[model samples]
Target: MWKPVPLPYKSDSLPLPAIPTAAEIRACTNVLWDGAHRIVALNEDVVVKYDGGLDATEGQNLIYLERYAPKVPAPRLYAMFEEDGKTYLILQRIPGVPLDSIWKSLTVSEKNGITAKLIPVFDAMREAACPWPDFYGGLDGGRVHHWLFYSQKKKDFKFLGPYYGEDAFVAGMLQNFRVSTERCERPDFKARFYEKYLPQVLRGHRPTLTHSDFHQKNILVIENPCPDNQGERSFEVVLIDWEDAGWYPDFWEFFMASDRNVFSFCDEDWFWHMQQFLEVWPAELGVMRLFEKDMRGH
Candidate 1:
């Protein structure tokens, strides 16, 4: 198993862009999205995402996709930097509104049309195999990272294992859970949890490049203009937010997609459409959720 490493650079050693303050970011009238740790602002054709000490892996992931998985429709990364404990990623803004904003308003036929477009994209991602079978986290050739065990306050930015097989990867996930909780100090409890639940939930599965958070919000949809009195107006689906994307077990995508945090509002039709591309294991998700509750002592 791979051990966690401290962030290599000190505060002063980071090569970064001019740090933009909260006031400066807030002043931007073209704010695209605002969340807890990151704020995305647009300036004409460029989109700048300012991460307030959350995660910098997305920028690197974008670069990796551009080079390795060019067929995947993602934003073009311009530049990235780490400054004053914040990470800034400058990217070419893809033309589209988030699917979530317009999903509820779309007719059933329109919704099916979007789902049809996504089918090929999901197939391509599943077909994009990693060069090394052992590599299980983050971009294939970039600095390793894991979004599942991430915490802003702890600053536990160390990369997890590039495990050789499914078993090792499952073990790595368990280790990460231990590290994230106070259970790290209790070996007996850890041992029991591992022996009891791990076997039930962790099954042998093939690995694939998964956009772990593949919910509506992370997807962008754009309607193309019909020219020369053409046929139907086509829509393009662009996947965004590669922060949580990585190579993982085939089931990882389904498990993460099932997360309520990913889908804020319940859309039965949208849910049904996603299942067509991938299968969800409710048994596995249930075990995982139980483990999470135990870790948090809830």
Candidate 2:
């Protein structure tokens, strides 16, 4: 069902990463002509991937998103495949500008619309039980039911000392996971943020197709709305980047977005954004609320 649509091609000229040139992209891989992924400069579209991961499900995301097009500002996947120990995923190079560049210029209605659209798309993904949840990575799966603890591949959790500390919590969570993760975790943070807010995180939730890393960077904004034939503008949303895509706790996405990199990425605007979005989501808060509590000794 999921397949790549053939694109009309002209002379091969691809837009590459501003810093890392295509040569660098090619040089990084083992097999240039037959590598896992290499740079193919085909008219402003430069791809970075590796098909030779020995993972049969490699490049599965290209097929997943292609079949289910979310009505938002995401990338257009044009092609995907693996050959000679390398994988390739070709996508339509989105042309317009970065959302962050024009975020302030964007009307609040536009921002609200984007926030609203995510729910439906998330629902569609959950209903279908489609894996490859985000631009991160995918998991071999079928229809999922409840929250799946990462007991199987339990990686060490890092702590950022009341900031983005997944490691410390990772250690602690592995310890008294049986104990309630409520008040014992709070320190210097405010009340509603941790005590009351976080406890709700894992109370009522089941994991669906969580993007695991749906930050704004992973979410691209292409064209702004233009006056339609009837003077109305309908927004089109396209999701891109499925390397980090996978099945995991929704808090992972919320945590990464809240302020990743030891809180170097904090933004009050996004703080309010989460507050408002949480009112709508109502579920994701429980998981993230706990993380917020664990991050602060203040």
Candidate 3:
């Protein structure tokens, strides 16, 4: 179960002491100047993260999910508080480790099997309701940020390419999708495919919630607990890090999820998969559609 960790909060209002030394903090690749994630110890409970955002609303979503919904395969949020410029998520650090560390060892059948298992969870989310107003909805709660859509007259929301590391290898993968799918008419459409995919082609299929960051790192393996966990592992696939989850079409997670090498299934397989995937993809997500719409004149 992806339940939040329980902590001794409230009575202890003051922020937890810093773990000391940038060396120590820097050692954990998960740490940020905006915050930090330390192991503490193998068995030691509670992951101490520091966040500067005053509201801590973003952090609260994890807390809420950790408490209310343990069955949906998300980490538990035990306690959180904001003081100074920092916020912390005292969560039950997920047991199994990052999926990528173990992805290479999985046989082809195992890989496809894992891919198959993830679908039902996606279906479960699709059948649910979107809590937020915009297309980007949160799984636990909705509307963590102020998101504006494109206006035909205005052409809004123009940030192109991956926003974070979890958005890793997206631009490159799309480039490959274009060349392999033979839709390389326009470069910009290749970039904004998802923006068009939603509300346009996918208006009908939009169901419940989606773990927008459904990649290797955010997902944890259950049966083969990363050799590190040794024993005591439950839940074969636990979804962690509900940062950008929301109500979205299944295609958002399906075709878009890729690796540095994460492309369509086979050589010509890209064409068929792209054709099938675009059934729901926004006009912007397809290079051909983009080339036709915004790049024809050029």
TM-score of each: 0.76, 0.50, 0.53
Q: Ten residues in a row with the worst lDDT in model 3?
A: 144-153
Residue 249, model 2: Cα distance from true site in angstroms: 4.0
lDDT of 1 by residue, 1-298 (tens): 2222223212222233544444565467776667755556555556678755555677767766776778889987666656577766667677788988888777766777788888788788888868775567666444335554443225655566667777777776666666654434545566467656786667867778888778888899998776224344457899998887878877778777777542443635677777777766767777766665665651
Ranking by TM-score: 1, 3, 2
Which ten-residue region of model 1 has the weakest summed lDDT? 1-10
Over 53-89, each residue of candidate 3 has an lDDT whose tens digit, in order, gives 3234435555544444334666555555544445555
lDDT of 1 at 151: 35
Shift in Å, residue 36, candidate 1: 2.9
> Tens-digit lDDT track for model 2 on 1-298?
3332332211133243333333444555333235433334344554444444422232454445544534323454444444455444544665544445655565566666665655566556555543332211143332111122222222423211111223323333323332223325533334434444444344333334455545555556555458546443334455554554444444555554554422532542544554444323435544555454543322
Better of 1 and 2 by TM-score: 1
For candidate 3, the lDDT comes to 0.44
- Reference-based lDDT, each prediction: 0.67, 0.42, 0.44
Please give the distance, in angstroms, between residue 29's alpha carbon in candidate 2 and its true position after superposition. Answer: 16
Give the CA lDDT, 0 to 100, for residue 199 in model 3. 32
Residue 180 displacement (Å), model 3: 30
